[model samples]
Target chain A: MKKTLVIDGAPQNCALTRTPGGMRLLVGERSFDCALETLGDGRYRLRAGDVRRDVLLAQQGDQLWVHVDGRTHAIQRINPLDALAAGGRGGADSTLAPMPGTILTVQVKPGDAVKSGQILLTMESMKLEVTITAPHDGEIAEVLCAPGQSVPVKATLVRFAAKAEATP
Target chain B: MTPQPIRRLLVANRGEIAARILRTARARGITTAIVRHPDEEGGLAPRLADDCLTINGPTPVAAYLDVAEIVRVAREWGADAVHPGYGFLSENARLARALAEAGIRFVGPTPEVIELMGDKIRARNFVVERGFPVAPSAIEADDPATFAQRALAVGLPILIKPAAGGGGKGMRIVRDASVLEAELATARREGERYFGDGRLFVERYVERPRHIEVQVFGDSHGKVVHFGERECSVQRRFQKIIEETPSPVLTPEKRGAICEAAAGIARAAAYVGAGTVEFIYGAGGEFYFLEMNTRLQVEHPVTEMVTGFDLVAEQLRVCEGEALGYEQSEITAQGHSIELRICAEDPSQGFVPATGTIHLLREASGPGVRVDSGVHEGQRVGSDFDPLLSKVIVHGRDRREAIARARQALRDTALLGITTNTAYLDRVLAHPLFAAGDYSTAFLDEQAAALSGKDEPLPLDLLLAAAALSDRQMVDAATSVPAIYAAMGAWRN
Candidate 1:
């Protein structure tokens, strides 16, 4: 079986093959005779030959968190269909509230052209001001929120029109 | 007022501090109650308390800050005293006054003292009038029209801070005079937004300053004493992330001088209970009083570790009108101690706060190590409150061993399902400057690149393998075997 996992924002290919006695795991160019023993409660002991290491694991949706050697690493399992649906904007068709917050200001409106990285709006959450910016050069299709509006996480604040590709 | 024992205590805070206070209150045979916001139903503090009372407001943070609600809860819970811990209503005079009016003791200084030290401008003026060293500065309230000119005249590099600010919020450093005006406007806005006080103050920005603070305890009997200073120079966004006892930079003579100066300030204010006096020490060894916190400080654990004193117990004792039985000479500190604040933030991402459910929480434990944790497994971490999840404190015979233990403790800590600064703090401890004990308030800013951990490449293969094997679908697919092979169990080719 093969899987693609995004680690630290970069995708890596992994292949797993079952052997008579155990399992052989290949990640990128490295291979290991890996056997994982569950110690219960998100704890696992991984044995690769004579070397052994303890790891803690938890999963939320497609995101997997693994703690090894005192550091926690977040990895995402990439789904081909989800990637395809994201398209060029990478799923960023609208500015979403990063956390539960109240909008403090809006710098753009529908029909306004914005450059990449231009600040579109500002919101306050946890007593800290968060600025939402354009992911790429695009035209604003609609502004869904206004100043003093309260929003929850992932709430769409502004929608952008599809970027117009330049002719070569 | 006559001395009286607190029969019932209500902790008017949450998180580790509440747990910390409850530990002492319970140990002393005092009944304890803790306030819990609805969102914090699963938090560790409420679970530790003998009784739990619900507090409500529009937001979780607001609920904690609702002075009226907290007071009413304390009264209804039949608590004889209230411990505000730190932050929230810890420094709010209104809470103290309200608690006092209800005939319940506030486990801190008098409300008048809290109001005096709560205002930065008023506190600075008080310290200056008492003949304590202070930095040159200008207050916007003194003359709003000429505040800008006066601030510029003070020096080239000035720090604009909100009069009611702490925890590094609403503070800006203007090295270049050109940006002073703009920074002032931003500072004022932040001040108003965060603290509801737009009043501004500008002071001389000490270059390469070290933040050393003394923990002072006082009582109604007019007695005061000082705990050795804690060096909290390693700060981010104007808040201390790493703190240690017996500042490595101070000589014996300097330590005595600084500690005495702190005690002097406390004595001058007639301060009671637990309070911390902060000073900005320059490279030249000269120190200036920055501010005096009228409540217990967040970094009090480092001092407690070295002095072998339960500061909360001392606060309770003082609140009961008991004098500090021991004099400054009798109070002694031993060995070295260090504390690392485990915050749910990504240091690599400019320390922006991170949020997620704490799916697995294995706090570090071992000899010479203590973890004051407020989180538990399956608890959700959000930005509604401070990012601090816990503190990792280690004590050793010396600074070197303490540093080593701190590094080891960081490795032992395993908080999964949320991004934290544990690894970043480990890298910081590994820095040569930190290990050598040669640093200042600007150390983090100066060594930001080296401490960022970006230059170190992660072990992608190992991480990916771990992730893959732990994944349910991936593991199921990889481990599944043919029915024939399953039927031929125990037979190897």
Candidate 2:
């Protein structure tokens, strides 16, 4: 079975496929051939070129766990559509996506000084908002996107002219 | 006592809690040997342990909960004692008995104590039999006829709790009896799946009762003690989001009574360990025993600060053949303390766990402030574990002062690259009920909107701050600019 793992909230995707007698994986644009076998119990031994390592893994049903070096890591699986669980509903005043969700609300106009952490052009991905907030005390320098704009992660929502006190 | 002679210890758990306990152990000259999953290493255990052994192999069941594997590790590492943190085998009586049989000291209560308290129905019955106030509860028969009869008498809005489970799972409030039969069936199934005991119990849901839990310590010599109480009123989905000591609403008389009752329960159980007796105090000051956790709690640090005692140290001492440090009269409740769980979730959303890279991290600090964290900058936080990133604990001379100080600490805390509940915590600490000490388990569920203000219009200044930050990122990165095609020959020339 092949599984797609989204890393670091980035749009980039990683695919891990277990093959017969071997393993193939794709990370970003890179591809590699590897050997994978269950060491014992649930432990797996993965050998890829010069890198040979023994890994202990636990898949929390849907969540993923991988050990690299000596440190263990738990990478959670997030549905880009359920960001509203953070409690911020979709549809706050038209400026921001409200929560860290995919942009679903775009209510503000250009030169809208979204106070601080104010609603800017809203972006909703996993039900949470990328509702870009006012980064510092400032006036609305520019509005980069319009309402219903589905921007990718890190897409600029609005620009602010830094306030007098905001400058060091 | 020469500081209870230090020696090697085995921490039998995982995640942030295990990490926190190891830090405390290391500070006092105790060597730690952590049991690691075949694939699971690093975290707090690798750095904290002087020795390490892989358990059952790799799967969480194979590793963390594999009591046999854990016993083998302790024996191989020559660990004289094993400290079961919170989850997994922490409250497992059979595991505790196994450790005792293996001649290894279990840092929690005795196996017999674990068995008694681990059984929710029996525990409740025992406390009530001793004349302690237990929420009026009765088990509904599995038979639909008897269950319906029990449901009708129990009335609507009763809490159907699995007689054998904790963590608020296998629980539901049935406002309409029409669904009681199905609800009972579902609860029984879940209870059996989780706790292996599908016994269903009914309790009149005490709406708006503040979820207060008393920290109690007992010794092997049958000496039981109470160290005041913690207000863990702020929660969602029955999970604690914030906790504090010297509950805001407790008068000296009320506090004394509550603590006394908690100690009574511990004493009755012959409980010998660091444990918490959770109670639900009604609006009128009538408190009911929710249950007793016969192991160290997740929020034991706040009690440590208020009382100036390292509870785990006491646990270590007592387990290592020491006497109870103080009597009830000797121990005094001091100051005010609060703990905010820094979760890895976006509060504006439905508190869904947010997985992201911690690009920046600056925790709160100052006089009477303590932060127990598992992640730092460059740390990869995910939902694979509990969403609690760290617990920010603050202390002050009084509750009001503590409230103000907690707000300041929250304001000072800034965790970027991922959303956190820091702001929501500020709102909770500022809530009138919380400040007035009139909170309950229903406080969040009832006044969630007012406390969190998820809908209150975002002020313009706050909006501007967000815009400015996003704008600045664009100006600084230079990566936002479109790629310009350069004529290879001309550019090279």
Candidate 3:
């Protein structure tokens, strides 16, 4: 299966396939076949690939932990795309909606050059602020949505000009 | 359909519900695989499973709800089935169909059942078309004025619910016309954000309604059995916090009617495996079909305790294509059972899903106590998932015994690090309204202010000890000290 997910604002096409002992995920030419199990307490066990045998295991909405070879690693995720999604409207794939909320703040404008996953707008609904982020390292081509302006799902808020291809 | 019995199982969910499923899977002699997400503070699931897998993706869409990732591991690990405990993508007909297409037996109902029951508008239409009484509601409306007027026709204090997504998200209670526009907008936004569409509908917000849910099971052979009802009257923010079997409000006649109505609907859907039909019982004992959760419910343990059956095991049997071993008549309710959702939230923070590290822990115990937790004492509670740490279930010979045992059990429980509602739950279990079994959705909302205040005078002594004892220095020293030394370190530290 393949899905176009906006991660921190950048659109990544992720494709996953099943391999014995785990799942083989392909995202931008990187593949990981991870052993997956649901431990039942909202925790799952996943071992990525046999060679890179360092099992990197975690769950959704969790703070962050990685126990590789009996060593525990604590990490925190910086959700840039979430920030863009919080900022009211910009891109189809790059802009994040307000977690299904109403747009709250418009932070940036069109022609704004943003780093990967920079917050361009913010939306507030139910008192929860969701930031919409720049999908990639690019200049915003157009800003179509505004603060306090409600847009439905799949409503285009911004457009992104992905970095240009280089000839080798 | 019984091609082979599953050897290894991949559970596709997180939290207390996932922990509960692990118990049954572990008991059945199957190897369990889990996908650990970051920021779990190294949750309890790490220590329980045979082998663990971690995913880098953090959000529900990236992790648990990522069907492709889940299915890939199930196939790679040679697990025969994936049990979606509930919520997340449990009702996602596509996920169910994906597993089916992959030749892996997805535990629970077939994709057919999932689709039939998952489409809220369609399911409501199916039941209403079949003569079942459904609350009057409207679908998508182009104009907000037309929508609110239609909603008012249904009556005031109406509920603006997302027509697509269920499980209380994207739901708003518009008490009067004053806030209808704002509530509708929020509901639509939430609906679209959560469910990929913002379409919403409105319904009569029943007053003083008892939130009762019925459990139904269907076999490969055409047969459906009712597992009585679970009283989910005690709720917070429109979600069940505490659940009990043999609702105090139900008469024998009422119970039969509610259960029968559920069974009829399940039969209509050709429901297979374990499923729940939720209903709202009105003041005069009238019942309306609220919705059907197409997967295992969070409070299944309470039903299991009263029925003396394993729901996961039953799902497995149905997946194995065996006829249900028990009939509707054979099923009987036993002793009372109650479950308190021990969550990591400050009830003071409007139950804002709490996030922090767990410094110390004491799980409740004694006879008839079951604690299903996802994270351990040292783990951090992540903001990425539901804040439910564990479901503490207690069974007793009667409701009074259960209540008393629950109170005592809750009192003995100790959790330090981030604040929890343990003290608040303790007060709730002891409250006259709770003890008297007078429960409702509004029970907490009505008494929230008073409850917070009433708790102020009762236990300075215990809270002081708990607070001082929970301090970092004391806790740090206690982590190393012997029981006697720790007792002394209470002041020294």
Candidate 4:
């Protein structure tokens, strides 16, 4: 089976085949005979060649957090449907709340043209103020939240309409 | 005054400090009560305490900072003494005075001492008046009209700071005179915003200065002793990230001078309980009194490890009217200890605070290794409090062994599901300059590029295999066989 996973913000193609006592894993041009022993509680012992290391794993939706050695690598399996929706809407569609916070102010209304990196909203979380900015030059399609309204992580605060193509 | 044992203690704080104090209190056979905000109901501190009370405020941070609420809870809980661990109301004279008014012992210095040393300008003046070394500076409160002129006269490259500021907040270092006024205004504004006190002071900025502080304890019986010195020069944005005892740079002679100066200042103030006297050591070996912290410090464990003293226990004894019970000659330290602050921050991202649920936590432990952590597995780590999650402290016969052990401990630690500075700190420990103990307060800032290097790419196949095999859907798809094949069963055999 083939799968596309985003590792640390970069996408990679992977192939996996079940074999006797283990699995054959391929990434790019490299292959590995991988066997995993579940240690329970988000922990696994991975054996690949001469390397043997304990890996801890946790998942929230498609997002997976894997701890190997001393660092935790963030991985997410890309869903084709979600990618299609995002591509159809635009390169990057909306500004989502980075974390759970209360909206301090909204900078624009629907139909307002915004330049890339323009501040869209100001928010307060954990006593620190954060600013949400436009990812690309586009028109604001909708404002989903108001000042003083609390928001959860990943809550869409502002939606952007597809930018008009540049005139020749 | 004779010694009076405390029967019940109220820990008016949260996080690792609270847990640290509770451990000593329990060992000393004192009943303990802890305060927690509603948001921190599942925190580790409350779980360790004998009784927990929920304190309320407009926000979680406010709840912890609410002096009145903390005092009320302490009184209602029938706590005979209150230990304001550090930060929040730990240095608040109002809390100490209020507790004293209620006939409850405040496990710190008297309110007068707190108020005096809490203000930077007052503390500096006090030190100077008592023949202690202090850097030259100008105070806005002293003469607001001529403050700018006086600050410029002090010399070029002055640091404009709020008298009531700390933790690197509201400080502006002006190297050029042309922008001094603008930076001063900005500093004053920040001072007002962050500390709510516009009182500003300016001092000569010491280039490549090392921060060395002495841990001092005093009692009402008029006794003071020093626990050597701690070199906390490894800092980011004026906050110490790594701290150690017997500052590697200080020779025995210089060490004696600094420690004696620290003890002199504390004894003059008649300081009681545990306090730290911070000094700014210049390259020329001249040291100036920076300020005095009138409560326990975050890096006190390093001192405890080397000196074999329980600072919290000593604080309890001092507040209970007990003498230090030792002379200056009796206090001695051996070996070297290092402490690295494990914070929930992303060093690559300008050290901005990170928040997430701690899905998995494996604290470093072994011989000569200790982990003081306030976080537990499955607990949500939010920005409502300080980003410090824990401290990994290691001790060795010497500095080299301590560094090696600290690096190993960092590798041994695994705090998954959130971004932390564990890896960044490991890189710092690996730096040659750090290994040689040849660094100053600007170590992190100076070594930015070196420390921020991207980790060597690991085998992608292994990472992907781990991710894929652990994934439920992927594993099921890989393991499942066709229905026809299953139906065939063992027919082929």
Report how far residue B492 has shifted in candidate 2, in Å.
Answer: 29
Between prediction 3 and prediction 4, the one with superior TM-score is 4
- Listing every candidate in turn, what is its Cα RMSD in Å to the true structure after a full C-alpha superposition? 3.3, 17.8, 16.6, 3.9
The sequence of per-residue lDDT tens digits that candidate 4 reaches over residues B85-134 is: 99889889999988888889899999999999989999999999999999
Model 2 CA deviation exceeding 4 Å by range: A1-168, B1-6, B38-42, B56-58, B141-145, B452-493
- What lDDT is reached at residue B435 by model 3? 82
The interface RMSD for candidate 3 is 22.5
Ranking by TM-score: 1, 4, 3, 2
Ordered from best to worst lDDT, the candidate numbers read: 1, 4, 3, 2
lDDT of each: 0.86, 0.68, 0.70, 0.85
Mind giving the per-residue lDDT tens digits that candidate 2 earns over B354-448? 66666545677999888887666656654335567788888899888888888888876666556677777878877887778776777776786
lDDT of 1 by residue, B112-221 (tens): 99999989999999999989999999999999999999999999799999999987888899999889889999899999988999999999999999999999988888
Worst 10 residues of 1 chain A by lDDT: A83-92
DockQ of each: 0.44, 0.02, 0.02, 0.38
Lowest lDDT 10-mer window, candidate 3 chain A? A69-78
Report how far residue B152 has shifted in candidate 4, in Å: 3.2
Q: After superposition, how far is residue B199 of candidate 3 from its true place, in Å?
A: 0.9
- Residue pairs with clashing backbones, model 4: none
lDDT of 3 by residue, B40-107 (tens): 45766656667676655644335777778887777787777888888777888888888888888888
Which has the higher lDDT value, candidate number 2 or candidate number 3?
A: 3
